[model samples]
Target: MELRHLRHFVAVAEEGHITRAAERLGMQQPPLSQRIKAIEDELNVQLFRRKPRGVELTEAGRVFLDRARATLAHYDGAFEATRSAARGEQGRLCIGVLPTTLFHPFVPLIIRAFRTTYPQVSVTLDECMRAEAIDGLRNQQLDIAFLRSAIDEEVDLNAYPLLNEPMVAALPSDHALARSGRDAQSLSLKDLADEQFILYARKLGPSFYEATMAACIRAGFTPRLGQEAPRITSALSLVAVGLGVSLVPACMQNMTMNGVVYRRLKGAVQPKAVLMIGLRRGDTSPVVRNYVSLVRKTAKTFRPSEKEAR
Candidate 1:
């Protein structure tokens, strides 16, 4: 029988009178009685017994009533869950983030604000390299990504540029530069020209790699590469161990490496590293849309000092 039949049966059973049940259901008494009768007929069992002033439920009726109520509750709950998800109030958001992006203030700010607004939405973070994050987004393993560059090739994706800041140098704690009596803030790229560099792989994040090389070239020397890592954080780790100095996104200075110190590059023209959010083109997920909007808004309020980005 249809759900309407169960509802009619429940109303009549609860009221103990067809007339009262019809009033509660906003239907006529005769129609209510007919619906109740149809339910019993479908089940081939007597569900109600007529009385002088009202009706009484048969043993079969009591058992069926429990089932009907539970079914209704389940349907109601399912409907609410679907609606909430569509409204972006409930769902799981898988985010693929580059390690470098995590050090940026705006990224965490956006995530925290989004969580506050959508408390019911669960967020999962996947820390990955630029190429891995992009692959995750394209493969549907991730709903959105925070990365270093936009997709230059034709793809069904959209990249929203979030932050563009100047690169900074990461030096070992005992390195000559750190021990120099000169002001660390006034350190120049040209000064590090002769030092070995710990660099990020070209394919992993080409944008930052190119920027580092460009800045070194502008300083009149190609860097001596000593080691390369797939992620910026890893490069910094190498710098901390004194393998080589590294030029990283200024925001990456947020990472606390015990043996490393961050210094601004002194130059009139410095190369910049960029952070971008990538998602599928024409994505209709409400959760993803809300996150993207929140990121844009958060970026607006983020005012990093020129010194912070040096």
Candidate 2:
């Protein structure tokens, strides 16, 4: 039988009179009675006993009524769940981000705001290098990504420019520059001509490393490349060990490493670029859209405090 048959049966059973049931269902008594009879015939069982006063349910009718009500409830719940998922109120969102972004002052704010707003949506975050994040996004393994560069290769992905962070130099505490009584206020590439430098992996993304090298070249010297680190933290840690000085995003200052000192680079344009994020184009999912909006709002209000200037 169809859902209409079950509905008619339930209405007649509840009212104990076909006339009353049809009135409640906005139908006529004869059609409602025929629908119920069709349901019983399809099941090959007598579902009711008729008397001059009214109708009474049989044992089979009682059991069928319970099953019909439960089935209808299940369908109702399924419809609601589907609608919620479509509205982005309920679903899973996997986000990929650069490991360095975890230390950025505004990243946590954006995550917390999104979580608070979409309490029903579940979010998973993965910390990866820029290249890995882009790969994950393209492969559909990640819903969105936050990184230094935009995703230009994939036409299906859209990038949102968040904020720009200037690059700074990280020097070891025992280095000669650190020994000088001069505070680590500002430095020039010329000042680092004779110093060993740590570099990020060229395969990861060349923009930051290339920018640093270009600045040094503009100063009429080639940097003495000492070592290369795959990730920003590893590079900073290498600098902490007195291996070499490295150019890093300004957000690295928030990471408290004992033996590393951060200094602003002057006289040359340091590597500076807006942090752009990629999301599936036209995603329009409430969770994704809300997250993008929160990121934009956070970027506007975020001003690093003095405590974050370390």
Candidate 3:
């Protein structure tokens, strides 16, 4: 009839005595007996055979006991699942990421750490271009995004800085600089003035585009534009084919293109490339918050200068 009725029935069935069931339930024997009687009357079936000493379950009582236990167990499981989801321990998190962020070692490190901490939470990732990732965050299609550069401050999102590293030149292995056979300690941006330059699309990262152009201008020559690719990795692929040299985030050195070599760039001021995480400013999802907290902790170990580079 009710959960309490099932519970009372179960207690009496297990103890095989109304007195003991009442003691176990912390209730009086009379109330427990009445509740058990009400359940049997509602069902129109005999649940027990009363004996001089105690009682014994009838065939119907055994069957009802099994069903009652199952129902209670099902309710308990549902309750736990709901609580876990609310705690962010078990749920799905959809993340949008720029392709370049995958090249950074810290990206995987943080992801692995988060997985270890919340193994029950399901994580799904989408590798998107800057524009797409931004749109996804704005539309609530993505819980968070890892970006190559910060979005405009006017956007209604919070950007958390993750990594800051200087730009490096990706040169064709057979090119003069790479074949000089010795790694130069550092080279200025002016040195590449005459060489054709491969770059990422301006729309993908306006800040990086401005920084590169400003560095070249400060070095006394505008970069000779050769080709533009949608992603930094694509730009590197172009460099490997000897189309032209490209400047990429230093962490991209981890990306190994067969014919490409990464060389540090030095100048009056070396422009730094930044990796950031973007999330809706009003997001209150516990899983997203947990991930943002982990990113902040990971950023702390990148050295104070890199942390402040943004």
In model 3, which runs have C-alpha deviations exceeding 4 angstroms? Answer: 51-53, 184-186, 217-221, 266-268, 302-310
The whole-model C-alpha lDDT of candidate 1 against the native structure comes to 0.85
Residue by residue across 1-310, what tens digits does model 1's lDDT show? 7777788888888999999999999999988888888888889999999999989999999999999999988988999999999998999899998878888877777888899999999999998877777788888999999878879683788898877887888899998888768785658788898899888988887887788888888788998988779777788889988899988888877777899988877776577888788998988999998889888877867888665655
The top-ranked prediction according to lDDT is: 1
Model 2 poorest ten-residue lDDT run: 301-310
lDDT of each: 0.85, 0.81, 0.83
**In the order shown, what is each candidate's alpha-carbon RMSD?**
3.4, 4.3, 3.4
Overall local distance difference test of candidate 2: 0.81
Q: How high is each candidate's TM-score?
A: 0.81, 0.74, 0.87
Better of 2 and 3 by TM-score: 3
Residue 53, model 1, lDDT: 90
Q: What TM-score quantifies how close candidate 3 is to the native fold?
A: 0.87
Best by TM-score: 3
CA deviation > 4 Å runs, candidate 1: 44-46, 49-58, 88-92, 112-122, 184-194, 217-226, 265-267, 303-310
Give residue 206's lDDT in candidate 2 (0 to 100).
Answer: 70
Candidate 3, residues 1-310, lDDT tens digits: the string is 7787788888999999999999999999999888888888999999999999899999998998899999988988899989988888888889897887877777778888999999998999899988898889888899989887777673688887777778877889888777664555457777788999988889877766777888888888989898888778788889999999988887777677899987778657687788889999978898998889988898888553342222
In Å, residue 264's CA in model 2 sits off its true spot by 5.3
